[model samples]
Target: MTPEEFAATFERIRREVRTVIVGHETLIDHVLTAFIAGGHVLLEGVPGLGKTLLVKTLAQSLELSFSRIQFTPDLMPADIVGTNVVMQDAEGRRYFEFQRGPVFTQVLLADEVNRATPKTQSALLEAMQEHTVTAAGTSYALEEPFFVLATQNPIEMEGTYPLPEAQLDRFLFKVKAEFPTAADLVEIIDRTTVADQPQARVVASREVIRQMLRLAREVEVASHVKAYTARLVRATHPGDPRSADMARRYVRYGASPRGVQALILSAKVRALVAGRANVSLGDLKALALPSLRHRIILNFEGEAEGIDADAVIQNALDETPELEEART
Candidate 1:
């Protein structure tokens, strides 16, 4: 698909998703960015924020298999990656076969992912990064356009396990599901609390989505934009000379190279989805928080002072060059 066509496709997805989810347009945008960038998403929100509904609506709008796995503390890696099973044939010959887990689907919703143990969470990292799962000394390729939409409750929630940084890096964006405005809440109530819940129409096929992903990758990004992205990533580190005062005081460790890569890829996709042939600094700024939120580590002082990652990223944006900001 051309850039213009890709933009139109995203509009269809937005319309379809909004039918079921009343608000949270930013959340939807980040999810779309991850989709085109071939990266997974980590959704953090309280209950009743429509995170689950949004994923379901997204799956419905695309013609692909969708599976939901509710992660629990007792869940094991074998439960997610699947284990070999022994079976007997009609001729009495025995052989072991691999049974695919819920991760095999094109869109996998790992609900309350942090509730699972770290081992179970690690089982999905390979699939998210490589789009394949290794089982029983054999590698099984996942379907094209594989996406893992994992949700997590707030840290205060009991019996929850925090996702390790290594596992967190696999996700392209860590979307925060914000509450709806009063008007949106009223609309939501009118739409769902009454008789009918809005239904989504399938707007794109798996093939069409793949084509759009290619078009997003084809979006041009200038050297200035690339440099600006690198600066944003670097500013997350406390010791970096270019880091802002707030970053030096609050940050523990900066984002890795993967964070910069995710930021640029997401920016390119965002530009294409907006019908732009090239990536702009605006695209980078819009995605900076979600791209770096999971990657940046907080210092003990920052945690004690209740300094969130968003504040540090905002400060870093202020340190970015005006020439780059204007281009965005």
Candidate 2:
């Protein structure tokens, strides 16, 4: 699809989703960006902030099979990835059969993902990264265009197992869902209090989404723009010469290469959504936070002082020059 066509299609899907979701335009855009970039999203927010509703609405707006998994401490790996079971055929012969779990669907909603133990959460690692599940020593390839949108409550820490860094890196974007403004709250109340609830209509088909993903990959990146993305990522590392002051002082670990990959991929999607043929430095700057926030680890002092990852990323953006000449 052409860039214009891609943008139009994305806007149509967003509009359809807006029928149900209130406020948070930026959040919706990031979610859609990750979706078209063929990446998963990790949404951090308190309960009743529409995180779950957003995922469900996105599924409704797309023509794909949807599955919802309520993650809890008692949840097991087999519950998400399915398991092998013995079954009897019509011929009366008993054989081992694989029972598919919720992860087999195209769109999976892992609600309160952090509430589940790390073992149970690790079940998604293989499926998210490899797009396949191994059960009983047999591999099952998931359907094409598989997307996982996981939500976790940030305020409730008790009994919650924080997602390991490996799992966090798997998500393309870590979007923080904020509470709605007063007016938005009024609008939300109006929508929910009435008998008629808005519903999102399917605006994009699975094939169209796949095409969008392919087209996003085709978005060009100039040499300098690509280098700037790399520099930004490198600056997050404390020992790197390009490291920003805040990153050097506050960060314990820098973002991994996966973080840089997500930055470029998500920026390409952003460019396409903006009807641009190529990614610009501005695109990289705008996306740096969500793409890198969860990837950057803070040190003890930074944590004690409650340093926000977004602040560190912003400082990196401020300090990192986009052009080579400006670097000097």
- The clash count for each model shown is 2, 0
User: Alpha carbon lDDT of residue 314, candidate 1?
Assistant: 92
For candidate 2, write residues 1-328 as lDDT tens digits: 7788999999999998888999999999999999899999999988889988888889888978889999998999999999889899999999988899999999999999999999999999999999999998899999989999999888456777889999999999999999999999999999999998998888988889989999989888988987888888888989887799999899999999999899999999998888899999989888988999999999998899999999999999999887874243
Runs of candidate 1 with Cα error greater than 4 angstroms are 322-328
Which candidate gets the maximum lDDT versus the true structure?
Answer: 2
Between which residue pairs do clashes occur in model 2? none
- Compared with the true structure, all predictions reach lDDT values of 0.87, 0.91
Scored against the true structure, residue 148 in model 1 reaches a CA lDDT of 87
What is candidate 2's CA lDDT for residue 46? Answer: 82
| Per-residue lDDT of candidate 1, residues 90-184 (tens digit) | 99999999988888999999999999988888888898889989997899999888888999999799989999899998888999988789999
Give per-residue lDDT, candidate 1, residue 132.
Answer: 88
Off by over 4 Å in 2: 325-328
